[model samples]
Target: MKLSVVDTERCIGCQSCMFACSRLMGKAGLSRTCIRVRSAGGMERGFVVIVCRACEDPPCAKVCPSGALKAKKGKGVRVDLTKCIGCGNCQDACTIGAIFWDDEADKPMICIHCGYCIKYCPHGVLELAKLEAGHAKR
Candidate 1:
């Protein structure tokens, strides 16, 4: 499966993804969202939806010393808080600024590609795609 960002031109900077991410973690606010949509230098440039692209070889996973980040089967990565040392290595390794920080937990928040936020995206900015049976060499 691939978690891809669709056309971002329609994004209105509503930040629904942020809320959805936080909600998935049972948070009532945006304090714990793995994804974040912030204004591009004052909102005139539109919005940028920040989230994991589920790279084939994720750099975040490589830099994580505590093994808090692990790739999931046919999907993105999941965080094991018990193993997280909060060294911020994953955050530094993320080139797209996808890994968000949970200040309270002192750990980086990441997308698991659950597709829950896709419903909240009114602009069709996000999508989850399933790979064909023989697409990737096993």
Candidate 2:
């Protein structure tokens, strides 16, 4: 399953999803979250929820010189932390800026599509969808 922003219009910019993601990492702040929600301009303009779309052929994984980021079929990339060299190549390769940095560890934080954050969204803005067989988005 992959996390989807089901209804961005329903989002109130409460950032519950972000908090939930961080909590999963046993942290008390936003620094550890793989997901981010920010205002497009201001609260009046709505917000943007940014997370990995689970690319079929993720550019981030392709650019990893250390083989830390491995592409997962029909999902996304998985990070082998021990192999990561803190090169920031994955962040540069992601066009959507979904890749988040852990400044303390100097490593990339990526979503595993665990759907833990979806339950915390008060507006039902997020969902975990099953990938259709043989379906691909370029």
Candidate 3:
């Protein structure tokens, strides 16, 4: 499955997706979640949902000293926790600010494109799409 922001304007900043992401990872909070929803500026300014775009050529993988971040075509980076040195290089290399940190483990949290959180988005701000080759992502 492929994940994408369907409409940020429709978002209510409920953070249901964020919680769902953590739940899928066997957690109860944002600590382990790859998806993030943050207030853009003020409450009236709306919210921004930050998640991996599954870049065709992810820079995070290029700067990863341990090669822990591996880019997948039409999918996001696959993180190898064992190989990861917790150096935060991948986090820094992410231009979209999708890389989330695990404060307890000192590791980066990248999306696996499971689409587990999409179902919890009550307002349809996020969605899962078919991972078709050459298909332009929204």
Candidate 4:
């Protein structure tokens, strides 16, 4: 699977995706949201949508000292909270800066690629794409 940036120009920077993620996890506030939306430069320069790209070999999982992260092919990695030691290696390994943090829990927040945030993206800036066979490295 793929989560594509349909059009960054259309983004309104409303932070709807962040709220959607929190809501999907049955929570309130953005402290634990997986997706992040921030201004590119300033309000007039538009915004940037930060989320997981579902890498073939997710470095996040590779750097997990506790084996808490599991890469699921093109679906992104699953975080086993029980196995997670609240280490920050996975967060640093993500080149795209998709990994988020929960200050209260001291654990990294990651996207499950559930597409929950897509519906709330009013500008149509994001869309999930299907990955072809062999699209990801084995």
Using TM-score as the measure, which candidate wins? 2
Clashing pairs in 1: none
Model 2 regions lying over 4 Å from their true place: 134-138
Q: Write the per-residue lDDT of candidate 2 for residues 28-79, one digit (tens) a residue.
A: 8898999998888888988888999888778999999999999887677899
Candidate 3 collision pairs: none
The better-scoring model by lDDT among 1 and 3 is 3
lDDT values for all models: 0.80, 0.89, 0.87, 0.85
TM-scores for every candidate against the unseen true structure: 0.87, 0.94, 0.93, 0.92
What value of lDDT does candidate 1 attain over all alpha carbons?
A: 0.80
TM-score, model 2 to reference: 0.94
TM-score of 3: 0.93
| Cα-based RMSD of candidate 3 | 1.5
How would you encode candidate 1's per-residue C-alpha lDDT over 45-87 as one tens digit per residue?
A: 8877777877666788889998889976556678899999999
> Higher lDDT: candidate 3 or 4?
3
Superposed by TM-score, candidate 2 places the C-alpha of residue 42 at a distance from the truth, in angstroms, of 1.7
Lowest lDDT 10-residue stretch of candidate 1? 129-138
Model 4 C-alpha lDDT per residue in residues 60-130, reported as the tens digit of each score: 99999988999997888999989999979999989989999888889888888788799999879888888
Residue-level lDDT tens digits of model 3 in 5-91 = 988889999999989988988999777889988888996999888999887778999999998888887778899899999999888
Report the C-alpha displacement of residue 83, candidate 4, in angstroms: 0.5
The CA-based lDDT of model 4 is what? Answer: 0.85
